[model samples]
Target: MSERVMSGSVDGLITLEAADALWADLTADSAVPTASGAFTCSPAHARMGYVLLGGHAVTTVSASGGQWSVLEVEVRRAAAALNSVGMDRRDLVRIGPFRGAPRLECDEETPLRWRQRIAGELQEPGGPGLAARRAAGRPYHLAGIDWRQMLVEQTRDRTQRTWWLPRAVVRLLDAAEHAETQWVQTTRTRQAGAAAAGAPAPRPYNEELRGQLYSVLSRKPGTARKVAGWACAVCRTAPAAVLDHCHEHGYVRAPLCQSCNTQERPDHLYSNDIRVANHYTRLFHTDTDDWLRHWHRCPGCRARTTLPLPHLAAWTAHIACRSLRPTHRAPRGRKPCGVLRVSWTGSQNTPRSCLITVAVDCCPSGEHRVLAQVSYREAAERFRVWLAETAPAVAAAAGPDRLDGLPAQLRPVIADTDGEGLALF
Candidate 1:
């Protein structure tokens, strides 16, 4: 339909038909992608609160306007104020200069409900969402929201650590990884061609690969028929989507997220390499695994502990930031946890591996010694008589991996009102 016709009336209020058309489009599919694609502003329009998303989703736009009514604000700042709500905002739409941009505040009920929604908005992808961000010492963004007239309502009484990976993001990550995994298989044929041709090198092939890669991988995606049980090789927070391959080797090295895929940092990648080297060593990191592992008897350092792991991380970092503080106190403010100190045993070890000794400390007053000594190869390689390959179970759960005996605070599934909390992401 023509923009003029869709606009309906001279007054800012959209024609009932335009509103109905928007509702129809949203009900059948979604208007989010339509708005996002066209979301932009020139300096002239920037003063009309155009820097922010006029409205990004069916739940977020409006005609009466609220904070978006302000002359200027950062986009991300405005995004904090905008989120999905139980009620619909697409039905009452106003127009912005771009193909789509709309803000809503026609009713006080929406903003009040919005506040309640933000408090409960724990599943925001790219978390901690605005709520969690505020809990983590970031400003709580409110649009159409005036801080002076209100009292603060913490989204959740307890601050939940990031444990549950948002299924929406996970779905995107899964597609990206699956597409790349397919690329890994398909490009084997193209590898020699691209490498041998040398000059132009598969630029077109690479572009085409990335373009097709985001069908389900895009922010607003298409069909997601496949999912690989893979997390981002780096952050592991979300699923890996980008296929990072060396041009010389046509096969893929790692699949990454949109953020990591774009911001190729040497330090972060280098840290990832080290993290990979130490991936098997589970005692150093902060996830529940590191603290939890110390609870039971390890064959290496069979000392039983007096405390639980947050015994030690939190109660499961969920909607409520349930801070599970340990009773034990550090005298000098050092971390009151086990000491996983490592020392190499000797150089005369076998050609395949060498030994290292770990000095362990189970937290009590003075000392009980339990040392875990393990082996590794400075440079490692493997030769196998039998070659076995594995693929992820097609029906495997795509949500966060299962946790056993962890605190309820860490469990996002505990707060699931929609029944999808425990299911695949």
Candidate 2:
């Protein structure tokens, strides 16, 4: 990746010759692809290409690596937008954050192009250029390893630069290897089998690929509902697959595909990092831990949450004694906590307009289900104390940082900076 090529080598006129110079395009190497489906583009071949995603044209310029580079860029852009890195903080679209927060985003922008032409290429198995498309229309990703997703998490964690990346990547591969027995796979299979035997799967779940991922604004449950009555919220060609809900809160979000179900479960972190962090930043977790205290003055539980997949609700309690607070019993020993599902509703803001249901489930079950949440500025204030305490340590964790890498043009337009380094709440 460090190798440099001449400007003429990158231009379209000399591209073929350049491709041959950097990569063994004429040889067998050109035919082979890396584990991630990266091909042997000639080192001299700086890539400029476009791919269609969800019916939209995605064009980007990659320095060395071909198509793979483009995908990596997308993941970073997503995280950069989420963290508001060199971007408007107002543009960030945060749905919610738990093990099951559905989506996160910011105003999209045309991704930046690599200023220098480097030496890396990724192509399909069909080979490079026209030949690849002739064989397979879409690019391939390693099974179970969503590289773009892994990178989105990597990009968010500015705290650990290159140090943790290898471990994260290795965990992703390990997960792929062991995916067959995992709950994400097995549970889907079990549910699918039940449906095949004539369970009431409703409409959305009946259609579409059995296991696709999804996101939506509403976190309402989507089961037993007639699909024909309404269209399931989806961003892909696939229709709704099934309902999505937070197992902890017992609140349904939307009808989701198999793909979305897997994303909702950050418990994948306990067995495998998969390199995918939660929707919140590392700083967010740190803040929640130090604050967000329980009303009864029990353990915060926030600190109990783990990372690289974090912001997951930690086990909480109203009192020090778990014996008095048993969870509700369910079929599986793991399913029930002998806790109660005590809930009621009331207004938060306008009379009867902004209704808020506060459930005081003192069951010591880790899931703290609050129906209403505070405004952004109010929530942001909650973190200010923590941010101030750690600002010195964060700033002093010295070395080349994410801010230093941004192009100067991006700083003013997208990045908002203050005296305390690159502050993206």
Candidate 3:
């Protein structure tokens, strides 16, 4: 009969169940049955010499001459079972002749020792030790075994320090180390590239934007064309075919749609155009009716009436005022406050003059009320007089509590002043 010596150390200590199963299978084929049957070997004779070095047996075995035959088939079966639970030959300290006995070297007895060994091994330019090499070669039996748990296990015997680990667990650790190295390399490359291109280093989180910026800086035709076809940076409402950039600093800012790109002043910065566009966009969406109503209001005829399209066009050409929406609160159970605006007019013969006006829907009456219409100087003077007259009454009424029994309009002006006093414009 052809015979081959089959022996290897587990990376970590073996469990009772694994040891029992392995011993049972090995001696099952024996003709004579002892009291312990298959597990008739001591810690030393069984090739697990670590037991002799103070490690306790996981499974109970009767005292008998350790003469169990280790068939190649039985050893392979034991290896497979250990692998299934994330234990493999990589965990072995030594494996040789059965009679000579395998050496269970106890180098890394504690977690601190294991860590130190790993660190030292990694620092070496040469390949890893025998344990690491075997681990890398072993196949993963279980799909997602927790490699960390395999690294350390609680021993039943306090005397036993070092244990074996599976090859699969070692392979996982190798892969993790490789990934970290690759990430460091990639980050350094990006920083170098950014510095060469005179661009700011990209943030780690903004991967997409960083890539886009790199493409722009490198002047990649395909990427630039693709970027130009993307949605507008300003509104994101239309396809941005125009590439916008700062004239002073020659770097591409962003792709803006045709409309946004076209609305710019000759001498003013592009940011000014963006601000104006944003203001109008907000105004148009917020108060569409107000925009249309004031589009062609005749200054001479103060009535709130809509004009025909043709007349409205003419009226807008003649008008010098821009109407603004009121921000003040109206009395409860009343119509909303009306337009508060300023107008300016000048001619060859006339000096430039500003007209500040306030109009509102007066309480107790639904009629349109023009509260004030005065020159800028006159408005300032009136404001000063109002402040002087109202400051003392406001200070007297103001307390730690809400002012009770005051008119809604006056209460908002006094009590709800946000530390800046009455916000009436």
Candidate 4:
């Protein structure tokens, strides 16, 4: 089994203010920068200040209209921290002695004094004195903005900058939260179900379906196996929710809830147009045509297709001929051609061979004649050549001068037959 390949990096931060700012930027329009530079403070910050902290900030294109509650939770928690710390605007004056004047009535030589004074005024509910005012409390009103209220406001101000975090960091954080929640949900559901039914949980299918799902979700281009793993992990199965099976081809199979499978209608399958649409959109620009061709059979037939999803290159090749009608079947009178034993030079590296066969004549009427005996490799090579020749013309339809940028894996295996774009083997 191939492993999921890492396509990017992960980022983490401890600064509370930074997290708040990032949360704000992502959710709010015309958002300003936070006073501090931290990207992601503690997750706790988001939980406490729900509205002020982590608000709605959708990073994924698909998630744009969806709500991201976890981010909001983190922001609220950050506000809680600010309230606990008692930092406010008035505390700035405590930094200098007399502010360029000869001397001030208060001693401004201590940083601890400033912190304490600031903390006292903000932390306490009411102001007692210069020192008592800095303690944690509700703030007093001034110029339509109470100093204490402003202090509380600043904490939330930082949480709104969601786009401030690096792309990798945002994904990693999102993944972490998703994983944690999924795991918890899966574990709890399985435990409850097992207790209720007195049976153990089912194991993952030994097949590569899990990896295929991951490919659809992840930004990285990948094989079916890699995609399946991520998809499985993201959609924890212990919850007894219906399963959505997606074929490498364009089709997505229906969801089969456990109870529905066992009790209601065992033979029935329910399709989820949303999942299919989502998968199609993700790789639409990447390999639109190929996927349509490869997944020709009904997606429900699990045994026919081993991997859950298809490689972009292979899918691309398949999609080109999806709409073509079959010409004819082999004549019954002809002796059946068995699978050809293909030998090739590149066999050691990729270790794959083409199954070759050709039409032959075995009829007594003398009408049957030996048509050909070409190897599948020859057919494929010829097909590739035809693809290359016609691709330019096809691409030219948009504009005669425009160059077609085909992927390397799809640079059709050309044939030697006059390059007329004909499929001759």
Q: Pick the candidate with the highest TM-score.
A: 2
Deviation from native of the Cα of residue 281 in model 2, angstroms: 7.3
TM-score between model 1 and native: 0.20
> Model 3 Cα displacement at 283 (Å)?
9.3
- Model 4 residue 51 CA deviation (Å) reads 19
What overall lDDT goes with each candidate model? 0.27, 0.27, 0.31, 0.27
lDDT (tens digit, per residue) of candidate 4 on 148-167: 22232222366431112222
Candidate 4's error at 5, in angstroms?
A: 38
- Angstrom error of the Cα, residue 92, model 2: value is 32
Q: For candidate 2, lDDT tens digit of each residue in 1-425?
A: 11332343333322322322322222223111222222222211124343222112223355554422333333223223222212222222111111223322211221211101100112224322333344442432232122222221222356531111123333333333333223233454477777787643334323332112222322235422333232343333333444543221222334544343343333222221111233223223443332222100111111111111112221111111223333566666533233222211221112233221222233446665443333323322333333335443432322223233222221111121211110111
Could you estimate the TM-score for every candidate? 0.20, 0.22, 0.16, 0.21
Stretches of candidate 1 off by over 4 Å are 1-63, 69-240, 244-251, 254-370, 375-425
lDDT of 3 by residue, 42-108 (tens): 2123333111100111212222354223333433343343334333433422110112211112222
lDDT (C-alpha) at residue 95 in model 4: 13
Output the lDDT of residue 323, model 1: 24
Assess candidate 4 and give its TM-score to the true structure: 0.21
**Model 4: how far residue 200 lies from native, Å:** 7.0
Displacement of residue 138 (Cα, Å) in model 4 is 17
How would you encode candidate 1's per-residue C-alpha lDDT over 1-425 as one tens digit per residue?
44743445334344323433433233232222212211221111222212213222211223453312221122233333233322222221111011211111122212222223333443456543344344432323222221211222232348633222222222222333333333333444366567776633211111222212121232232211111124445455554444443221122234454444433311111100100112222322333232222222111111111111111111111101112212255676645343333333333224234443434333465553434433333211110000011112211211123223222332111111211211100
